[model samples]
Target: MSSFKPSMSEPKSPGSYCGVPAQRSSQWGPEMVLVKLEDCSHPLELNVIVKEEEEERGIKEEEEEERAFTEEQRAVTEEAEQRAFTEEQRAVTEEAKERAFTEEQRTFKEEAEERAFTEEQRAFTEEQRAFTEEQRAVTEEQRAFKEEAEERAFTAEQRAFTEEQRAFTEEAEERAFTEEQRAFTEEQRAFTEEAEERAFTEEAEERAFTEEQRAVTEEAEERAFTAEQRAFTEEQRAVTEEAEERAFTAEQRAFTEEQRAFTEEAEERAFSEEQRAFTEEQIAFTEEQRAFTEEAEERAFTAEQRAFIEEAEERAFTEEQRAFTEEQRAVTEEAEERAFTEEQRAFTEEAEERAFTEEQRAFTEEQRAFTEEAEERAFTEEQRAFTEEQRAFTEEQRAFTEEAEERAFTEEQRAVTEEAEERAFTAEQRAFTEEQRAFTEEAEERAFTEEQRAFTEEQRAFTEEAEERAFTAEQRAFTEEQRAFTAEL
Candidate 1:
């Protein structure tokens, strides 16, 4: 018998023939045979042989068995080779399908990346165009504003110049009028002062005259009172001397009456003495006759002669006293008559002086009243003259004030007219400024609308271009995939 050996061309998988095992044949001696593995794509064959001593006695039987085994082995080798060839063809077809799918995926990714880069470029160009347009519009607006400001400044300068000229002329006119009014007021004040001075001087002179007249009247009154007092003293002196003379005359008359009574008594007594003497003689004669008869009557005749002598002497003395008393009474009566006449004269003079004094006092009172009336009339005349002067001054002042007011009214009217003209100019300038502002706003609105319309048109065109590019890329990818699929088939 021979041991089994195997030959390999290349390395193979470990479990390629997992289900097949080795077996021995009973009819044949112990020998190795060449056998092919079945599950592998390539045929694997091995050869072996066996030798024996009793083989001549059964030679025919062994020769027949060998021929049958050779035929069976050849059939198995052919079947294994056919199955390996089918498996090789299926593996080559699958490799070609995988390479086609990988090429399609790479092309689609490259197309998508190119589309995104183009979109970014388009957006950048649009942003740059919008910025340039905005800068141009800003420059144009600045130029327009500069021109409008220059025009407004020119108008303002002209208005200021005209206003300054008007103000200068008005100031000059006002200064001239003020000077003229001042001079007129000064003259009026001086005239009023002179009139007041004259009135004051006249009043002073009248007052002095009134005072002098009053002094003269008072002096006259004093002199009249003095004369009346002196007359009264003289009357009183005459009355006293008359009263003294009357008292002395009455005393002398009383003594003379006593003397006259004595004289009458003496004459009567002498006659009585003579009668007695006669009676006594008769008696003596009778008695003597009687005595002579007796003694011769010698003694009786002597006694009768002595008695008659004594009686005659007493009678003569009484007659002288009566004649002296009669003379004294006559003188006394004449003195009493003279004293009564003197007293009457003194009373008459006092009465006359009192009447004269009363008359003088009445005259003085009348003169004083006349002087006061004259003074009052003079004062009234002075007051009337002063009132007339004051009225004239007031009239002149009123006329001057009216003239000044008229001039002021004329100046005020002129100023009001100038102010009205200035207001009109200001209103016109304000209206012009409003018109310019409205025009500027209208222009800005029109420019903004135009810019919006242009931007909308550009965006629409960009969108259409992007859509066309995407459609073309999709068509090219489809054609490439179809061509690769056909080649694989």
Candidate 2:
């Protein structure tokens, strides 16, 4: 062989520490060759495989933690919903209590109105009775006055008759006893002259007495006539007074009825106004309750959605952390495999490097897929949670509106019923008033009939009296009746 020294351009040695081929070297030592050979066979490197396996385990644990966090989030959501339901129930209960109180108030007001109406009716009846009694008293006074007048007239007539009878008897006795019966005529001439003079004086006295008697009789007759005329005038006045009294009584009854009707109408209007106010209050309360319930439900929904979102975010964060960790582990694995490339003896490092690059690409692709899936899942869960919360809120609002409408309908029905009751009560009151008025009129008529019958009986007993006396008594009775009627008026 030609003394051959390996060229610097020759391929690198397999076991050289530097880039050189192996050579038989006596300058160093034979042991160095064995040591070098041993070193070459045993490759020492920073082992990264164990660390990669540990990183993978850590990633798995992180995923498990994320799952546990999601479970805890679900439990929290359930607790929130339960609390919201309890609050809603409490609001509903409070609204019901308010409605009951309003209803009780309405009932009390109606009862009070009815009591007042009854009191008014009682008062009216008492006034009517008082009026009737006053009429009776007036009639009695008139009758007493008439009877006294009639008695006085009768006595005067009797006295006049006696005086007339005595004058006739005295005239008859004088005429029967003649002047020739005189026994001793002292002087015929003197007796004749004295007798003549006495006769003339007697004649003059009789004429004067007759004139006085005529004047007395004329005066008595004129007094009786005047009395009869006064009685007639009193009778006419009494009749007019009675008519006026009746008219006044009728007017009073009419006015009372009108007032009662007005009162009833006013009461009905007040009742309606009260009912309307109550209905409005009830509606407001119901609406407020509905709004409160809806708000509570919305809050509950918002809370649940927030909890769900929080849980989702937590899960996403954990997944993102796991992906980051996995990426780091893959990069570390690739770096460690690259370091081993330089240590490998005679191995095709390019092939191994290519395989590692392919594995790294594969792992990167897997990590990308996992991250995308986690992001997509998180978005879907968020959308689903939001939709569910919206649906719950909408349902709550609808339920509240329906309940409010029903309450309003109930209130309207109550108002209608109250109005009907008021109308019926007014009608009853009017009917009762009419009946009382009729009773009063009937009583007055009975009193008048009794008075008339009494007068008739008295007249029958006084039939033997002079016509003038009877007329005077009748006139007096009539005048008394007029006075009573006028007093009543």
Candidate 3:
């Protein structure tokens, strides 16, 4: 064996096959070789030689042609695969968008449902408020009726006095009574105007509340519209509009019911009909909302999308909640105002009643005082008239007695005159009994009318003043006449 020669190292070109050099097997023909250089004794490793280059050039030309065909096939395959992958990714993205949109719609529907529920609760509360207002009106009416009854009873007691006194003071107090009537009318007018003002103010407040509700609704609608625009779907917008219409109708019904509560007359049929309609409509809306929610769950989405949508939904819910809270606050304030108004009205009415009572008491006192003074003056005049009448009657009786003694100087004539006197005395006694009955019927003998008392005094001065005064005066006149006659004899 030749002296051991050092084996040449393998090529270090960049091309490799299972860690083998590209310059491997240069002596072999243009074909793959299974040779291990380390197994060869004195392995001869060579660079790409001339024969190998020429053969390699020829083989490279063929490989280039084959490579071009293979490259064309592979490019076609890669393009097909890329197209398939792109289609699948696009399908996934569209599915994700659909899922996200469905989830957002579901969330929106849930929020809408919550708002509707809240609105329903508010409507119920408003209905209760209306009922309470109706109760308050009824209570007020009852109170007014009670007050009127009491006032009438008081008036009846005032009228229970003697008719004689009324006549005495009728003309004197007529203007005052008329003034009181006018004052009462004015008071009633003031009450009516106050009630009207309260109604007007309530209407204005309701209008303001309606405006606030409309503004809130408009804002909510704007948000919904914006959300619809974001969704870019016509179906969603229609549904949202339908929901808004339902909510708006419900609100309108609530307002109508509230106004209906103020009606003095109760119409139960119409109210029940409206309530039934509202209930049916609400049921339908709930069914529709539920259907919509069920339909929304048929898709899928990403966590980030869900998070964003949840945030938006939370914000909307927060806005609704805030509006509800504000509405509650407004309602509470209105209730307080109404309560205060009622209390003030009661106080005003009580004060007016007390003032009226005071005025009436003063009027009655003045009337009594004036009547007493008139009676005193009339009594004085009656005494003077009686004194003058008695003197004239005494002179006439003296002349009559002289004529009677001259004309009736016969026994038969005296007997006829005595019979006539007896009949006249009986008639006078009957007349006295009649007067006594009349006096008893009047039930106020001492407080008889001025005309009756004066007539009685004048008649008694001519005949008998309540019988007792005439009897005593006649007895004294007889005694004086007897004394005079006896002195003359």
lDDT of 3 by residue, 74-177 (tens): 56865785576568557756865785586678568756865775576467547645754664475356446534653553354335332323542356455654
Collision pairs in model 2: 13-20, 13-21, 238-482
What lDDT is obtained when candidate 1 is compared to the true structure? Answer: 0.44
Residue 390 error, candidate 2, Å:
7.0
Q: Please, what are the lDDT tens digits per residue for candidate 1 over residues 323-366?
A: 33234333533553465467757667755664575476458546
List the RMSD of every prediction in angstroms. 77.5, 81.7, 69.1
Of the two candidates 1 and 3, the one with more favorable TM-score, higher being better, is 3
Better structure of 2 and 3 per lDDT: 2
User: CA lDDT of 452 in candidate 2?
Assistant: 76
Candidate 2: tens digits of C-alpha lDDT, residues 1-489: 011111222223344563233354454343222112224344221111112335545865785587568657755765675576567556656755775586578779856865674475456436544643553354345435433543453344334323433432355433432232132123334644764574466456535644653474365346434534644554464345435534666668567556656855786587568667756865675676567656656664665576467547645654664565456546655775675566556456755875776577568657656765665576567557656755764575456446535643544465466646544543554454455457556656755765676577457535634664666577567666654753452
Say which candidate scores most in lDDT.
2
Candidate ordering by lDDT (highest first): 2, 3, 1
In order of TM-score, best first, we have 2, 3, 1
Model 3 stretches astray by more than 4 angstroms: 1-489
Higher-TM-score candidate of 2 and 3? 2
| TM per candidate | 0.19, 0.33, 0.23
Error of 1 at 58 (Å): 7.5
**Model 2: number of backbone collisions:** 3
